[model samples]
Structure formats: structure tokens, C-alpha cells
Target: MFRNREEAAEQIAARLEHHRGSNPLVLAIPRGGVPMGQVIADRLEGELDIVLVHKIGAPGNPEFAIGSVDETGHVELNPGVERYGISPDYIDSEAERQLENIRKRRQRYRRPPTRAEGRVAILVDDGIATGATLFAAIRSLRAQNPSRLVVGVGVAPPDTVERIRREVDELVCLEAPAEFMAVGQFFQDFRQVEDEEVIAALGGESS
Candidate 1:
């Protein structure tokens, strides 16, 4: 419905202007969120950084997330994460693995951290699907004690939107599709966001 992701991001930037002037930090879920987050960083004259989160997948069916892990080893489980027959130790082990990935990504993305604690943390993503990643992203940001935690997405489902809205101080979403499927389905040019592009965006202070 929007002209594209950039236009959608720019609109979000307009609504979020107050935070920008107040030392707000924009954190993008890498690979996809970087581009949109970059536009926001530029408009707001704030700082841009990456917040890493890995989904805790269902046993055997690894693609389905039972929960998620943040860069700081924060674990959030679904109502019945125990139904997977996994132990606390096993989940901790997975958290360690994800933390390692987060480290690698931080190095690759140039390790930009604008002030996680006191600043407003505006988490961005190209879009939201099952809300698993976005859920993890918000919980992770919350642990950092940001003055405000916001979830910004180009699109999401209404249910996911409502749930996330409760957790964050603010939510700037362009579209809540009636029948949400994959995040890519809504984008006309939803290509894979490359790591190089993420690095380049980080290097120049996109915010």
C-alpha cells in the first residue's frame, strides 16, 4: 500500500521526531531493518546501532521458534516452552550459541552502541511475521533499561501489534495486514538484505 519501505520509514521518522532530538537511539534488526532504520537515523539526527536477537527454535523443527535469545543472553519463552522437552540447561546452551553469533555480528557490523541505558531505544525491522523476532527484540531492549522501548515495523498482524504495543512505550507501524503471512509477501522487492550492506550502513552513522 505504501510507496515502498523507504517511504514507510520516512513517515515513521516524522512521527518519531520528538525522540530523535532527545538523544534517542535507533536499533535495527539486522539484515532487513538496517535500511529502514538508516533513513530514520538520517532524518532524526540520532545514532543508529544493531540489536541482535536469535529465535529459540522448536526441537527438530528448528524453523519454528519456541522462544528467542538476545545479544545479552536474555531468554524469553512461550507459554509452553517446556512442551519441547528441553531442559533449562539446554536453553542456556542455546543462549550461549546465540550470544556468540551476536558477538560475531557486532564485530561485522562495526559495533555501534549509542547509549543503551538512558536513551530511547527505537527498535526497527523491515516487517514482522509471527512476532517471535520482534518479541525477542523488545524483551532484549527492555533489559537494557532504555528510557523508552519502541517497536517500529513496516507491517505486522493486528494480534502481534497489540501484544507488542503493551510491552513498549511506543509502536510506529505502517500497516497491520488483515491476513498476515510472511513479511516478504508484502514487499514488492523483498530481497535478502546482505551483510555488507548492513556494515556499510553502520559505518557512516546512519542516524
Candidate 2:
């Protein structure tokens, strides 16, 4: 397990060395992704920015994601939603609710969304669990027409890594263990990431 996000970032940054000087943009899914993105941007000499996406939780099990929504109100539903008996109306309302939250988050960042046109865009998170939000982020970023899209993370389930691999040009994951439980299980210090830290990271200040 990584000692912390810093160590994880260092490893991901090394794997992404080839992208250095390519004018790549590291757009992190806040708040956990900010620290790692900071290291990657500094190491690759790339621009840092935020990409907002939030999970749409399943009914009765709010922690279980039924799908995810991006900043642009684009929704991507899990195929398993039918198995869960989730309804279209629920999905529609949840997407709206999530879009509202994403709006507030964008305002909090105080920077216009970065245009991904013709430049490599690397989306980083501390780790991936359900991967619903990452999937949503990828689809939304794809709409921006990035020259190339990359997924860099500390750890994820093997299945998740494979699924995301097909969606992006490159996938750099430090660990992809079988039988994963949660993202935090792979980190020794997986604490909650706060808004202040995200702001500091965006401003190029150490948090």
C-alpha cells in the first residue's frame, strides 16, 4: 500500500514521463485527486485543472453508485441498473441533483473549465472503486475532443483497469489487484480530502 497520496503521485508521475513537455493537461476529480494531480503537473510540467463528476447513488444504498453525472449534466448509467430495478425517473432526478452539486464545485474552483481540444488530458484520482465517476469523467472529457485521454491512478480493481483501458489512450495504474474491496484499502493513509486543500493545489500551493 502507498504511504500516502504523495508517494502514489510520484509513481504515477514517473509512469507518465513520456508526456512531459507535450503540453498535457492534468484534470483531477476533486477533492482526493488534487494532491496527486499537483505532483503530476509539477513533474510533467503540465497545466493543472479540475474536472467535476459525482456519483448517482442507488436507492436505499446511497454508497452504491447506480451511475454518475458530469459537469455538463451528461449521464452514464451502469448496465446493472436494470438488475437493481432502478427507474428512469430516479436516474433523471439523480442526474439533475448531481449536476447541481457539480455546478457549486466548479464555482468553488473559480477557474473556467480547461479546454481539452487537441491536447492530451490525464484524469487522475487517488484510486478507483466502482469507477462510475471516472467513467463519467472520461466520457465527458471525450466530448471535449482531447487529442489523447489518459487515466492515471494509484490502484484499482483489475476489472476496472481493463474497462477504463479501452476508453482511454493510456492507463497507468500502480496496482490492480484482484478481489478489491475499496480504494482506501490500498492506501495506508486514506483520509478525507477537503476543499481548502483542493484550492491550494489549484493555486500551485502545497497542501
Candidate 3:
């Protein structure tokens, strides 16, 4: 178990030591991954940036992701999302709502645009649950033609780890427990990450 995100990031950065001097682009999922992204970026001597993607939740359970939409409005529905009986209209509206949140986060973060093409891109997140957002993130980053696409996370379920492993060039995950409940369960300090923390991690002077 990780003491905190900082400890987990340090371990992940050590595993990615090969890219230490490659000046890779470290793209983190906001609200949670930013803190770890800052640590990894500093350790690897890479630039830090954010990739915006939001999960489209089920009608009743907002925590249950049926699909995800990226910043560019590209939507990816899970293979068995139809099992949830979610209608096309519902999916469309949810995608739009989540996309709007992404837009607002983009404006708030104010991170300078950085391209992943022809660069080594590493996507980081605190952890993975359904892998919905990470799936969309990988697809979005893949479209950019990054020379190498890597994914690093703190913990994930065994099934989700294998699924994500197939999507990226390399995946550096610290733990893949078979009996998983949630990401926070694996960390001692799993407090909610506020927007101010994200802004500060991205080198912005948060007010």
C-alpha cells in the first residue's frame, strides 16, 4: 500500500528511469493525477501537461461509468454499455455535459498547450477503476502520434491492468490486486484533490 500519492509517484518514476533523460511529455489526468504528474515530471526531467477526459456515468449511479468523452468531443462507450440500457440520447447528453466540465477545467488549469507528436508521452493517473477515462485518454493521445505511449498508475484491478496494457506501448503499474474495491483503498492518504492543488502542480500561482 502506498503511504500517499507522492510515495507512489516516486516508485513509478523509479520504474520509468529509462526515460529519465528523454524529455518525455508527462500527461496526467486532472483532479487526481496532477500531484503525481508533478513528481514524475520533475524526477524524469520532463514537461508536465494535462489530458482532459470525463466519464459518462449511468443514469442512477454517477460513479458507474458507461462511457467517456475526451476534450475533442470524441466519445468511447464501453463494449457492454448496452447492458446498462442506456439510450443513445442519454449517452449523447451525458457526453456533452462531461465535455463541458472538461472545457471548464481546461480554462481553469490554464496549462500551456503541449504536443505529444514525436515525443515520448507518459499518461499518469492516481489509479484506475473501470479504466473508462484512461481508455479515452489513450485513444486521444494515440491520435497525436506520440513516438512512445506509456501509462503509469498507482493501482488497478487485474483485468483492467491487462486491458490497459494492450492499449499502450508500455504500462508501469505498481499494483494489480485481484480483490479491489476502490483506488483510495490502496492509499493511506486519499483525500480529494482540489483545483488549487492542480493549478499549483502545473506551475501556476494559485490564488
Candidate 4:
């Protein structure tokens, strides 16, 4: 188990030692991944930035992600999202709602996103559960035509790991236990990351 996000970041940075000095771009899924992204970016001598993507929660159960929408309004639905019996209209509404949130975050964070074109880009997150949001992030980054894309997370279930592996060129996952329940269960200090922390990680003053 990780002592905290810092320890986990150090381990992940070690695993990615080969990327040191490569000037890779580290794009973090905000609110949780920002701290780790800062560490990794410093360790690898790369730039740190945020990738905005919000989960499209299932109807009546906001914690359950039906899919996700990225900053560019690109919606990626899960393979079995139709099983939820959600209408197309509902999906459209949810996507727009998420896009608004992404916009607000972009403004609040106040950090200009770095382009990934022709560069090695790495996406970092605290952990992964269903991976709906991360998948959307991957697709969004792919559109930028990064020369190489990598994903680094503290922990994820084996199933999610395999699915993510298929999406990225390299995936650095610390733990992939077969009996995973939640990402927090693997961390001793899985506290909620505050917006101020994210802003500071990006060297922006909180508004």
C-alpha cells in the first residue's frame, strides 16, 4: 500500500526512469493526479499540464460512470452503456454538462495546456476503477498526435490494466490485484484532492 501520493509518485517515476531527460509531457487527470504529475514532470525534466475529462455518471447514481466527455466535447460511451436504457438525449445533455465543468476547471486552473504533437506524452492519475474517464482522456490525447503516449497510475484492477494497455503505447501500473474493490483501498492516505492543490501544482494562484 502507498503511504501517500508522494511515495506512489516516486515509485512510478523510478519505473519511468528511462524517460528521464526525454522532455516528455506529463498530463495529469486533475484533482487527484496533479501532485503526482508535478513530481513526475520534475523528475523527468518535462512539462506538467492537465487533461480535462469528466465522467458521465449513470442516471440516479452519479458515482457510477456510464462514460466520459473530454474538453473538446468528445463523448466516449462505455461498451455496455446502452444497457442502462439511457436515451440519446440524456447522453447529449450529460456531455454538455460535463463540458461546462471542464471549461470552468480550465479557467480556474489558469494553466495553458501544452500541445502533445510529436512529443512523448504521459497521462498520470492516482488510480483507476472503471477507467471510463481515462479512456476518454486517451482518445483526446490521441487526437493531438503525440509521438508516444503512456499511462501511469498507482493501481488498477487486472481487467482495467489490460484494457488500458490496449489503448496506450506503454502503461506503468504499480499494482494490479485480481481482487480489487476501490482505488482508495490500496492507499493509506487516499484523501480527496482539493482544487487549491491542483492550482498550486500547476503554479497558478487559486481564485
Q: Please give, for residues 145-193, the per-residue lDDT of candidate 1 as tens digits.
A: 9988877889998988888889889998888978888887777777778
Task: Write one digit per residue (lDDT tens) for candidate 2, span 1-207.
Answer: 999998999999999999999979999999899999999999999999999999999888878888999988899987667887778998899889989989988877777788999999999999998899999999999999999999999999988888999999999999998978888988899899988888877773443
Candidate rank order under lDDT: 3, 4, 2, 1
Please, what is the TM-score per model?
A: 0.90, 0.96, 0.97, 0.97
lDDT of all predictions: 0.81, 0.90, 0.93, 0.93
Q: Tens-digit lDDT track for model 4 on 135-191?
A: 999999999999999999999999999999999999999999999998889899988
The TM-score of candidate 2 is 0.96
lDDT score for candidate 2 against the true structure: 0.90
Candidate 3, residue 133: the lDDT equals 95
- Model 4, stretches more than 4 Å misplaced? none
Q: Which has the higher lDDT value, candidate number 1 or candidate number 3?
A: 3
Evaluated at residue 104, the lDDT of candidate 2 is 88
RMSD of each: 2.7, 1.8, 1.0, 0.9
Between the candidate structures 1 and 4, which one is better when assessed by lDDT?
Answer: 4
Number of colliding residue pairs in each model: 1, 0, 0, 0
Index of the highest-lDDT prediction: 3
Misplaced by over 4 Å in model 2 are 204-207
Q: Candidate 1: where are CA atoms >4 Å away?
A: 204-207
**What lDDT, from 0 to 1, does candidate 1 have?**
0.81
